[model samples]
Target chain A: MSKLRPTNRSILRRLALFAGLTCFVAIVMFPFYWQLVTSISPPGQLTQLTLIPDLNNASTDAYFFIFRERNFGRYLYNSFGVASLSTLFGISIASFSAYAIARMSFPGKALLLGLVLSIAMFPQIAIISPIFLFMRDMGLRNTWLGLIIPYMTFSLPLSMWYLTAFFKTIPDSLEDAARIDGCTPIQAFSKVIFPLALPGVFTAAILTFIYAWNEYLFALTINTQDAARTMPVGITMFQGEYTLPWVETSAAVVSVTVPLAIVVLIFQQRIISGATAGAVKE
Target chain B: MEIRKTDGSRLRKGLSERQTAYALILPAMLVIFAVAVFPLLQTFYISLFDLRLNHPTRNARHFVHKLNLEQYVDMTDRGRSALASLSDSDVSDDVLRRLPAIGETLDRLHDTLVSNPDRLDQYERVRDLVVTFEPVRESSLRYFRISGLEANEALSLAEQLQDDVARAIAATRESPSRQLRVLEQISQDVGRSIVYPNFIGLGHYAAHFADTRLWSSLINTMTFVGFAVLFELVFGMLIALLINRKFLGRGAIRATVLIPWSIPAAVSALIWRYMYDGQFGIVARALDAVGLIGDSSVMLSTGSGAMVSLIVADIWKTTPFMALLLLGGLQTIDGTLYESARVDGARSYQQFFRITLPLLKNTMMVAIIFRSLDTFKVFDLVYVLTAGGPANATETLSVFAYRLMFRQMNFGSGSAVAVVVFICITLLSVVYVKALDSDMLTGHK
Candidate 1:
């Protein structure tokens, strides 16, 4: 009976906790809400500072304005193309390297781990000058391959870290069983282990996609051509003709963010796990 | 090269484990090398010389002195034809007397330019490219490296010819101003046609060491990283603690909070810049309404205000990520321990200090190390939002390096800045490894 009806003190405590959590979340998410409100409003009433815009007056005219005026579709294609290619290449490359590091007891394993670790910590600016020059000389400055190569390289460290740890957690008994059945290590990895590690590879895919999608420095440097810019560079250098640029920028942000926000919403747990890969112990 | 062991259980002969492992990682190592290691070495190598792409003579990295043969040939060839016309009967005797000496100097310079057999060969090819214009592309073929003594001899001859031209110019003051100007310009062009070797060993580093901009940017980087990490940790802990408990809207709260971190940094900068806008931003108006500032414009205008505003945005953008990390750490804590502490009548704060804080140290170390290095290399946020603006109070090392390397096209100094950033991050990593744990290298908790 007492458990069914909590005490006033406990009720108040729960209410206070809920209220605090709600307030903090609202504060954190208010920027996105504001961006939405600003993006939905027509250019005439954009600066009205209304929490709830007059629904009858609000219009998503700016979305059409961005696509029409700016070559936003090109940027969208470039971002998606570059990000997907890099993620695909990054996953395959990182998986092989990570499997060797995790499963095999071999010489030079520690040195290889150290090499990849430092490459992970290697700052992008340290190599930007030479890369820009090299890409320009190679006639790859405005191409997708140029961006994909660097993106793939930088994404290797994180994917390798996550996949190595994930592979280590899988029992060795499974591989031994497969080997006893006369399967090679590669055959076992593909036939038996690879299917089980799909969750980890999926997590790495999401993270690396996000990385290549959000990468600004390389994209800004290499792909300065109007048609080759990614979403980040496009929105940063956004210029709208009729609608205000800020609103169009907000619309661009909204368009790209909606797809990603859905991914984050659906995979928040996996994303968190992937993010805190090496930071937390099981 | 298959070797079958006599007593092996498996019958088929294939690659050894060591060879297979090496083969597996060979592609990744090559990619990393091509992208990261090779470029890093190239940048460091380029930093040793004064490489300026915009300047005509100093564009390429040269080891020895060279003459800009295209411009030198064009100027002298045109001067010879134009000066020959000035030797008509109407020209003054004083100028006429000096004319042969100038012509003789030009002939001597031509001989000296192609004097050595080696230079003569290289210069003839370049002269063919310049002189034959239709077949060969002259753009890529320029700047032959010449000997020091030849360079000195050619430069002295050019100087003597310029002095003779000046004397002739003074004697022929009756000539048209345009003719005098053309004569003066030819002499100047002839004098300005030598490319000096721009080999400044360690000079960029030494000069940057004394530069206040470098030191102040370092200080700014430290200040930004310190405060951002500190606030993110505190707020991240609070949020982590709050969300760790059983709640109805926990999923919604977690997902909603992650939206900021999921948003691109450049986009986050855009949202914050809008929210911190003086006239139309709701946050600005609310801050003004609360008397937090004299006006809304003050947030983005003043240096401290801009820093504080950006810091607040950074905290908002990244605190969720930090919280998510701490929450991962928090979940790994055995719940029964907390329950035992509660049964022992220990208060929540005491339980936190004794149990959670001590247990969360490793996670904190890893999180802080990653975040600090990342924030130290912060470019997109500062680059898009403030752009080291108002007075450069917000300039970090990455931003400074970018401005020098990309915007100013000063690759040498910019690379020095980049190397400084790399060193500082390395120093920080060394400190963390020494102070935190050796497990960092192993990527083990």
Candidate 2:
């Protein structure tokens, strides 16, 4: 009975905890909210220091401007095309290698794992100059392939790490059982293991997509022409010499962010798992 | 190749499972090599050469000092015109006397350079093609081999003659037309046309090691990484702890917090940039209203303010990610351990220190290592926000290298900077790896 009603001390502690947690949540959510408000608010009223977004003056002018005035649509297509292709290539390539690492007792396995992880840690700037020159020499610059190739290379490690962990979790007994049931190794993997590892595959897909989507430095350097520029590059270029035109930039920002925001929302748990799957133990 | 066992009459051989496994991984290995390792090796190679795309003559890799034939031809033509016109012009007695002497010297140098008729023909052909904006196919015909000393002597002599002509023109006290200035400029430019071999192996690296800008940028990078990761770790831990408990709206809180992490970094930068704007920024206004800052503009205007602003935004942006990782770590911790600690009369703080921290060490190490590396190579944030600006206070090594490589088009120096960044990053990774491994070993012990 006494446990039913909390004492003042316990109540105070709970209140304090709730207050702190709320503050954290608020801090995390506020900047995004501010961006939305600024993006929607009338250009003239963007400077107004209103605590709440003035709904009355809200307009989709900036969004319209991005789609109409700029070649942002082209940037959008390029970003999506490159990111999707990279994700496809990255997953297909990594899955095979990840499975081999998981199932096969291979020589130099540790070294191979170490190499992939080290590649993940490589600073992009270190190779930017060389890649720029090489890409130009190969006539790959300002093309979707140029961006996709590097993106796949970098994103491969993450997908491999996730898939390897997932594949390792599936018991070896399942494959042995499938073999006993007259299934070839390939048939067993495709029929049994692949279906089970779908979640891991999805995780890799989401993470890789986001990476190629968000990638700026490589995209900025490798693609100089307007048609080949990604969303990040396009939005950055929008901040031209004369004026920033914050409203249009914000609208472009929203366009780039909304699709990612939707993916995160829909797959928040999987995204979280994928992200922390790297740092945390299985 | 087929192998036969002595016990077996013959061994039917095809690709082994191990070979298939190797085959599966081969594509990934090759891709990594082509995209990552090959570029890194190429960067190292390029760093050894003196390659600048901007300079006309010294643009390509030069192993030996050579006179650029294209430049030599253009300068000879221009010099001939300048000298020939100078003799016809009304000038001082000193100018009249020096004009003929300078012209003769120019002719002598021209004659000496073109003494080989074959080389002269190649030079004239290349010159004609260059003047017509046609690409010269043969590099050998474009640059003539010349000793460094000879090139230097000719350059100095030409410069001295130019100076004398300028003085002679000034002595007349007549208004110098644009034509005269153009003539003087052409004369001055001819000396620079001599391309000296700029291949200085390990020279940029040597110079950069002592370079103040490099050191300062390194310091800035370290400071930013240290503070940003530290803040993220602490805040992340706190959030992780708070969210780890059973709560209503837990899913909502989890998803809401991750929005920042999900947003593109460049977009987040833009958002924060808007919020940190000196004018019309709600954050700046609010901070000023609360008297935390003397003025709103100080946030983005000053170096320390901009740094603080960036740190705050970064903490906000990444703490969720850190929290998510820590939360995953937290989930791995057994609840029964806490119950046992409580039964043994341990307080919550004592229980946390004893139970949570030691176990959480590995996760923390992993988080810190990854975050530190990411922050160390920070470019998009600093770039989109302050652009290493108000005077380069926030300029990290990556940004510095990017500026050098792209904006300035100094590939040789920029490649050196890139190499330095890679070395520093490798060192940082090694430190973390060693620390993590040692901690694990000690934990096991």
Candidate 3:
């Protein structure tokens, strides 16, 4: 009877906890929900204070304007192309380098690791002008290559640095066993090591893609032409030279942001784990 | 069987050797070298040339030359003498017609004066000499000689001298105290000039050290970063504590809390900017309803208002990040610590201060430093929200650099600003990296 009393009290405490957590969660998620609601609400009803819009007033006209009037689809393609290419190139180069750092006893290994990590801390703006001049000299200004090259500079450092840490976590014994079983070094890496480190690779890919996609200054500086501009840059075009069209701008914002939100929700666990793993591992 | 055994042994040796590591690392190193190191060196190289694309061929060799005010004055004196002699000469039409060589000499002299502004006083002296000849020709034409060949030649020479003197005066008038300022302005006009110039032994550092704007921005950045990080940490800790408890739909709550962090910073900042819009924004209306200010109040139009807006926007976006980090830290703390504290009759506040805080010190530092460094580099929020407006109240070092590089097109000064920011962030990173190396958060010895 006494144990039952404490158990019942605990259940009540848990119920109170649920209510508090629900409130906090609502506060946390309200902005995104608001974004979605505002994005879809009729132009007339957008200013309404209510959480839920009148279904009769809701329409996808804003989205239509964003696509038909703004050409947001092209910006999406540019962002996708730049981010995907950078991720692919950054990861492949980082993996091979990470593999060497993790497995082989190389001369100046510490120095190489130090250099890669140090470059990660450098502000991109410091080198922006020189890079701009270099690209112009090479006839790469306002081209995809202009944005991609600098994105690689920023992405490769962190990718190589983090990938190296992840590579170190995987046991070398597995690679050694593969080698003894008549696998070449490259074969052992691809067949055994690469598969084992897919989580790290995914983490690196996600981080690289997000970094490249979210970048603003470099993208703005390097890609001035509409053909090369990404979503963030394209969003600025919605705001004319002086006046901003809030309704249309919000529509563009929602379209560009929704895809990223979907990505985050789907990969929440991996992101959470990956973000904390290196920091926690010391 | 013998061939296979030999091949296996060779492969093992190759795998274990340093050569394989070099092979793997070489490509990345080459890319880094090509992309990062090469450009930096090239920028330095470009800085040494008097290479303005607008005026490409002027003083190309002496781009590395540094002249003092005295040397400039001497050069200007020589130019003045040459101009004076040419003005005073008596030559026939044919002789005067062959003076294109003298014209070329005058052009070179003008280039020297324009390129080197430390000689401005000397340029002013030359200008004075030419101006003296200007009225003499006009007076002589009006009174003595009207339309003769001799009169035309004298008037033409006087006009040419007058134009050259005026150009020299204009160049000198545009000179700034520091060589770097002149170089930066020149670089902007000539887009192909080096992005970051290293003028060795320049006193720009001293000048910047004395500048009040630098200190003010630094103090503002520190205050903003400190408040934002501290408040976010506190709010985040509370939220983490709430979420850590066993609750209904905990997974959903966790995901919801992460929503703010998931939104891109630029998008969130833009959203917040609209939310704080003075005319129709919900916040403006809410504030007005409470009589916080007039209905016509511009929340971002004043310095304090802009700062407050930035802090609020930052807290909203970053509290979730802090919560996520703290939650990870919270998970590592054993529940037994709380149980033990309760058993010892310690109050909740006591338990928190003694047990929770002490245990979370390193995690707190890690989170604080990371957030602090990030906030110090605050750009998108300030850029979108206020753009260092209302009399440059919100201009952080990063914004200052942006204005210099992009708006002003002064890459040299912009690079200097960037270097300063880099130093500040590097200092913070060093502390964090040290904390990371010591396994402070993991509680490892």
Candidate 4:
């Protein structure tokens, strides 16, 4: 009876703590939830300030406006193209470099590792001038290549670093076994290690994609023309020289961000693990 | 001859192994060299030249050739000839050798007069040079009459020599001013002409270090990062510890806390900007209700208020991230450590200090570094919230660099600012890496 009484009291205390946490979480989530609601709420009712949109007032006018009036589809396509290319190119290069750092007994491996990691720490603003000049000279400005090239600089370092960590966790014995079977280094990496490191590759790919997608400074600086503007750059158009359309802007924000949120939700576990693993040892 | 077949096979295998290794690492190295290192070298090269696109004549081969050492010697000879023609007496090499020393003495005298206005009459030579240089140009005929030296007779050659000396001093003063004006004009023109040029130098960095505006912006950035990180660490730790125990619907609560972290930073910034808007936002309404602020309070209009609002928004968005990291660290601690502390008759506070704080150091450091770096380069939130406005009170180094590079088209200074930020972050990164290394080595064993 004494044990039961204490257990009952602890259960009630646990319930109270859970309720408090739920409230805290709701407060944390309110901004995103409000953004979603504001995106779908009818234009006239957007300012009503309700938690949920009235069923009769719900509409897709803001999204429709973004598509027809704002040329948002083009921006989305540009964002997808640049982000996809950067992620693809970044991962391919990082995978090889990561392999070299993790497995090869190179003379300057420590210096190379330190240099690569240092690149990740640099702020893009500092290198903007020289990068802009280089882009202009190469005839890359106002083109997708201008944005993609610099975006690679940011993502490649991160990909190389994280992928290096992931590659280190894999035992060398696996690679040796393949070599013993007369498989060359390339074949061994492809046939044996590559398949095993898919999760890590996936993690790197997602991170690279997200970083490129959300990157604003390089995109804003390099690509001034609308044809090559990414989603984040496109959103800046809502703040006109004299006026800001808050409602339509919120709607546009929802459109681009929802897809990212969905991706995060789907791959939450992998992302959490990858993020913590990279961070914990830093 | 018997082992020849085995030897050939071994040689082929060795060659193939080298080739495979090269193929694996070559592409990444090439990309890094082309994209990162090449531009850095190119920027360094450009900074060495006095290249400005605005000087149309200077763009020609003749002007470029004229900048050589031979042309500079020719200009010096011509200046000497001009002074000699006015004096009507050939100045000897001995006098020319003493000219620089005499000029330095005159400059010191002038500086003393300028600093103390009462000392003006004490420096007669400098005063004569300043007064007569322009009048001598206007009244070339009167130059000899005023000094009582006949123009044709060149009477009292020493007085004519004094005139030459004054002219030389005047020319020296005017030459630097003229060069400065020309340089300024060229820079202004270049600023207007270049679309985007890779300019690399420390000029902007020096200017920023000297300017009070840059210091103020840096202080604001540090203030924002320091307060936000400090508060987030404390609040996030408390929240994480509170929810560490098993609870009903804990999963739901944890998922909800992740919403802010999951939301795009840009969108959240915009949302908070709206919430803090004075015209009819939730923050203003709540503050009014509590009588803490007036109904007409514009949270973002005032400098302190805007800073506080920015800090609040950042804390809201990032506390979840801090909590998540701390929660992960909390889970790693052995519960038996706490049990033992309690068995030793320690209070709850003592147990937390003894068992929890020391164990959580590594996780806390990681969180602080990440958060501090993110806050250091804060652009999206500040850009969306204030645009570094209300008289440029909140302009961070990044924002200032952007305005210089994009708005004013001053790539040189902008590049310099970028270098400063890079150096600062690099130093921070070194500290972080050292701390992490020590933490890992200590914690693992």
Local lDDT at B148 for model 2? 73
- After best superposition, candidate 1 residue B295: deviation in angstroms? 2.2
How do the residues A1-282 of candidate 4 rate in per-residue lDDT, one tens digit apiece? Answer: 335756877779667776767678777777667766777777665346676667687777888898899878998999899999999888998898888777665455677776676666667776667788778768899888888888776787778878888888889889888888877678888998889888899999988887888788888888988877888778776677865666777788777766776777778666666656656664
Local error of candidate 2 at residue B206 (angstroms): 3.8
> What are the runs in model 1 whose C-alpha is more than 4 Å off?
A1-4, A239-244, B1-15, B68-101, B134-141, B163-186, B191-193, B438-445
TM-score: which candidate is best?
1
lDDT of 1 by residue, A150-262 (tens): 99999999999999999988898898888778787799889888998999999999999999999999999999899989989988888445222678888888898899999
lDDT on C-alpha atoms for all candidate structures: 0.85, 0.83, 0.68, 0.67
lDDT for A269 in candidate 1 is: 84
TM-score for all predictions? 0.92, 0.88, 0.77, 0.75
Ordered list by DockQ, greatest first: 1, 2, 3, 4
Error in Å for residue A55 of model 1: 1.5
lDDT of 1 by residue, B1-445 (tens): 2234574622323336767788889999999999999999888888887887677677677767877777776677678777777775466677788788778888898888767786677666766666666343454355566678888898898888878778878877586444445666787677567778888888899999998999999988898999999999999999999999887879988999888898789989989888888877788888999999999988888888888877888899999889988988898899999899999999989999999998898888878988888899999998888888768988889999999888888988899899999989889989988877555445464
Q: lDDT of model 4 at residue A186?
A: 80
Off by over 4 Å in 2: A1-14, A173-193, A240-243, B1-15, B70-111, B114-133, B138-141, B153-193
Model 3: how far residue A136 lies from native, Å: 1.8
Interface RMSD of 3: 3.4
The TM-score between candidate 1 and the true structure equals 0.92
- Candidate 2, residues B1-445, lDDT tens digits: the string is 1234653423212235567678879889999999899999878877877778786765678878777777767766776776777668776666567666566667666665666877678778878987787776677877787777777677777776687657656655567644456567767777766777778899888888887988888888888888999999998999999999887889988998888887777778888888888787888888999999999998889989888888888888899999988988998899999999999999999988999998898888899988999899898988888888778888889999999889988888889999998998899999988998898889889
Q: Against the hidden true structure, what lDDT does model 1 obtain? A: 0.85
